[model samples]
Target chain A: MSNIFPEVANKVPRWILFGLTLKVLAIIAGLYYYFTPSYTRAGYQPVQPVSFDHSLHVKQVGLDCRYCHTFVDRSEHSTVPSSNTCMNCHSVVKADSDKLALVRESYQTGESIEWVKIHDTPDYVYFNHAVHVNRGVSCVHCHGQVDEMEEVYHAKSFTMNFCLDCHRNPEEFIRPVDKVYDLQWEPEDPEWEEQAQAFVHDWKVMPPESCSGCHR
Target chain B: MNRIITVVYIFLIILVVSVLGFRGSKSRKEPLYLFPDMDRQARYEPQGENPFFEDKMDDRLPPQNTIARGNALDRAGVFSSGFDATELTDVAFNTGRDEAGEFLKELPIEVNHELMELGRERYDIFCAVCHDETGDGNGAVKNFAPPTLSSANLLTQLYIDQSEGEIYNTISYGKNTMMGYADKLSPKERWAVVLYVRALQRAANATADDIPEAKRGELGL
Candidate 1:
């Protein structure tokens, strides 16, 4: 309080002043980019042929995504559930509703329901649900909080570099099956968790090591 | 004073970290063996010759089954056949007795109505799209082609008379264009479909006399 620097007059140096200004500018730029919600591939809220409430059907009703999107494990394209699957339940459940009308129309009309894929990655990037899920890649790692989404929306910034961040070190991002595609998913027990962590850290998994891991 | 304190703090940190790191490296790994007393302390130990370092320690260990008069741990895991660690088998660690033997020593899957019903449900859910409600390959996907399944001669030989294991194998590993239903159906469900296929075979070949009391009028057989 009373002239702390008694030996030398309290003075700010020129270089120190310049350094402070540069640090402040860097902090400002970093914060701006970090908080910005903008992305390269904008979210696709495309009006699907049937206004499918993924939340109502998948989450609320507990109708498994597998029940509708059957080919997730076996095939390249997780083929849109045929109208027949819809007709299985909707044949009785929502028979009067407009969703059922669209489904029935598809059956009578034999026209395919154009479902706008929510989590669409690039064509070159070969992503398999079976291998990724089986190997420990979380659904939320790619798909975001799908269970909560009323109409599906892209949750994560799906850039190649974004994927490469996880691909580089899979153990950092990948998790068990129950946590996959889940929002508030936590590992059930600590014993299983320790085992899971051991499995991940011990085994080597890298995209660069496995070309088909990404390419195929 | 701050500069001296910082330098002293850093020096202390470096010492602590070096100690911790050296100790940690050893703590992380199992010490395979102590270095052999160099057969008269040598001046230079090069590559494979240098023992008990991180990279070359694997070579320092004596070969499996080698007789050791003094050191006994060197011959550790000799009987394990090249593997230093004991392989953890699921069956051995799990209940000691044969697991399947305890559950269904004899496959208790008796020919029953419930199995047929389950088979029918699975067949309708999976196979009906390509192989119709009847065993005829005239499903919704068939586009009303020449009945691939209706031929009685083929149903008798290809499916009905074949061993249950063979039918199961066919369902597990698909044939031609038919995708394997292993992913879709469980092992029990696959067998169930095999049972349903057999039932369908019966329905196809049965004459009017074979029609049941309740369904005789319904089929007009």
Candidate 2:
């Protein structure tokens, strides 16, 4: 038979096969990196109606986390403070400032401020702020160094794996109950591991690893 | 052919990097959902938005004049009148006042070390920001506030002369330009704060003679 195929035909088939393999590999790599909560959820900084500065309130003013999040240790959900809580200080301190105009209006109108929420978990996952906080989990563990942030952002991935990592070994994360609100707190003792283990034992912090524990 | 393949690979890499960017990069855009699958249910969450309501709020305020359940007077033993429990006219524990609408001279709840400790914690969290740790009205907030809005000096003679219930009322309903903490502090917590405030007043006014004989040596009084 005459040379039915062109001289480049052999190279063309090989190149096409190589390109298909590379395409598949690229897709796998893309999904592996981009599908995670780390890429999708973390570092989400939303613009709030009023530019509330956490560093100013927490670092300078020296207010406790519970001062505004009063129900953190008492209720399932840690509530955002009402406009009245802002007016508590602003009414006297910066009463006429333009920055507090929205707060003043919300207080007078008895309307809820449209503050954007961060760190939202999936609907199926049931997370309780009081349960974790009461068990010596510091706010900084999940929320990061909010006392230093000028604008709050989602600091942690909050993936199921992230939660499970703590649940599996809570002794690695637990601190003194009194120091839960003290975000700057660190173990002064060199033998901090022993102290954490002791807390896990004494407090009976048996985090459920079963699916029903969280999904229910 | 080899050169063409190499160039295509490089282009593909640049495309991916430009589109996805780096992980955890700061972004103002909302998190993109690849597999939303029941991630956000239709059910209402606490403080969630609802288009159905005029206020666009899922959390509705309780109807007017409706007190939440489970707020009954359980700790009125300290100031219990001779009257029977059923016949008790005024719940002093909740109101911080007697049936005659007068502030109670003393706390209606029994004071103890536990309650005092709770008072210290709650006071530091809610009151010390403005009232100062020593009740001197010089707190972190005082540095920012005008002289007219300065927190009250709880150790002053004016405050010392006030009754416990009056102090409780102030903590609950607030006084002057101060906003009420009734929402933040429960009735028992308000009383605990009152006890702590009284202790602060006593400590501020104490003399060398007031120190206990055993503790005096510790302070070298």
Candidate 3:
């Protein structure tokens, strides 16, 4: 007991220990939020079997979203293009290209390519593409500028809070029905804010913010 | 001792800042979950194989005769007849062509204002994406150079004189690279779409006299 420990350590105040613990906790919280899939999945581009380039098809080729997602407006889920749909053009355009091997196989065998789903919500949450697309919500709103994306990824987190942020104030997102497919569409005019507000009223887009609205 | 405490504080600050800067980074590994809660719940994924069922396939077919909701044709007054030969004289609702193998000229349903409006709306939804809004065939997919419905040499005489039944057949069964709408659209809606296509053809090849005399001046016709 001849002062083996440093006298300074024994004399240390409890407040400093408390402060260090608080700092360590803050660091843990920061790391937790940073590592969540919502942040990491934003740029989570998966390698598709066909190596399909949305930029080439959508921007340069000018294909509409409905061309591949044929059932966006008619069905709750946006159906992926069937092999027949792919063969519509691939039968001639890139019929023998090495890159289109899977496309050819799928078309010939009548089997699906098994494209990986990037933007998946919790099984509890129900989402409808028809409701959003019909109400003038552009695909760009959630999917981002898909026309520019070489490979598509989840542009937005489909968390309850992220969804509620829009459902609460839909006027900020509403646009004309015709501009739904235009990725570059924006409120350019000075009165656009007022116009968007008017549109929300005119279309009667009252998205529910309650838990049952989506959970059910 | 004070220097050591300051060093610890600096290290903690650096750690927090570095973690915060990792936002939007891509990770191949799955995210850490505190509460799995319905996320990792036991359920069969689409096309998943399971040994629990006799078939061992998760994708089970619907019961022998139990139709899915909204799929019963009789309820919707939509019949899925391939050919209507009940009345040899009546060719309506028939997918078969006449003795000459030519498409029938008369539409099965009468054309009216309401039907035309409905046709236009449905046409915009289903056909306009590929057929183009003006039916000029300059649909958004021009890069692939899909066939146009408004080609003067193609649609003007060809589609215009092809007969309504032929066009209807094309819409129902699909022609060439175009996918058929028999599954997506009902029989009556298909007829309405045929009428709308005819209307588009007329508009595409319209002459000066085809317009109303009063509206001619406004259009500079």
Candidate 4:
């Protein structure tokens, strides 16, 4: 009875094995590339109740980040400005504009504007806005150049590794304390590296690499 | 066999490209979490919704007629040298008034170079948008604001004649069209702004004699 059929029969088994291997590799590659914070969370742009333009307020109008986010330097959570904060200017400026109808209503009714949050961390991560801003970590680092964004969107991956990149070497990112709010500020001096290192040392910006640092 | 393999490879490429698209492309949909893990928990986040409350707000306002606990004046004393234990009992620091219920003529906190610098920084952040960088009425908002909403020029004679405590009260509680910044600025910071405003007033009205003989040359006066 001997050797079954033709030599091509043996090759058919080999071809099927090769195809299986290719299919497995493709699936693994797809998962590795697509399932990451960069792909999933980086570009979330939720619609807010009001179309507040950051570029107009921050870049052109020259409002500081603290003008609206008043508690950023003092509290763990950065306070979203009350509608009263909006009315502080809008009540005088665009008092009758249809665009600001929601804002005017919120101010009058003493109701909170349901502004959708963009940059959110996992529940376990205890990130403090005060500690970062006070330690020379500019808002531009994590939030990106919000002064340029007309409608704010997530600009960076807030994954554990993304955070670790700065924590491991804060000298690469931290700027002068005075320049933290100035997003346009760039280190023009050739000795910026040395200056950043000095700031890291002086500020004692030893961000923890251990789990407890953020998790707890 | 070769033809079949080629077809399979092409199919895989199309599948990956179509499914993955491109990273960082804008999306209105919520992020899809594969594992989810504990990305969100059953805890109340700041500014989050709570159906348990009648207002459906997790953050509750402080009850009416309740003053914050602790020595509010004493807390401000930590930042300045002028306040003593005797002044802790006095409501002057918080209210910007004296025992006579009149705005104090001088700052409750001691004025120093550091306080002045802080004042300048805070004023630029909080006030310069409306009050202008040089304490002039013309600021970025002046273009949009009507005459009724125009910010007061701190350098004007009206502001110069005002007492330090009166200026502090204005900064804290706001005047006319301006809104109160009591929630935004601490008592110590309000005092610092008052000092900076006084400096601006003096600079605006300075005669050649007002400048120091040594510093006059710096200005090419």
Candidate number of the best DockQ: 2
Candidate 3 all-Cα RMSD: 5.6
Clash pairs detected, candidate 1: none
Give candidate 2 misplaced runs (Cα > 4 Å). A1-18, B64-90, B208-212
Ranking by TM-score: 4, 2, 3, 1
Q: Rate the local accuracy (lDDT) of all candidates.
A: 0.55, 0.89, 0.72, 0.87
Candidate 1 segments exceeding 4 Å error = A1-38, A177-184, A191-193, A201-213, B1-189, B192-221
- CAPRI level of candidate 4: medium
Candidate 4: which stretches are off by over 4 Å?
A: B65-89, B147-149
A80-147: candidate 4 lDDT, tens digit per residue: 99888998888789899999999999888877788999998889899999999999999999999999
TM value for model 4: 0.93
Which digits, one per residue and each the tens of the lDDT, describe model 4 over residues B1-221? 68977897988789778877877888898887877899889998888889999888888877786656754545663546564554455578878898899999988877789999989989999999999989997889998877656788888888888988888888888888898898888888888888888888788888999988999899899
Give me the candidate number with maximum TM-score: 4
How much of the true contact map at the interface does candidate 2 reproduce, as a fraction?
0.83
Off by over 4 Å in 3: A1-11, A21-25, A28-32, A35-37, B5-21, B28-34, B40-102, B109-153, B176-189
Q: Interface RMSD (Å), each candidate?
A: 23.3, 0.9, 3.8, 1.1
Error of 4 at A5 (Å): 4.0
Q: Model 2, A49-138: lDDT tens per residue? A: 999999899988999999999999999789999999988888898889998899999999987889988889999999999999999999
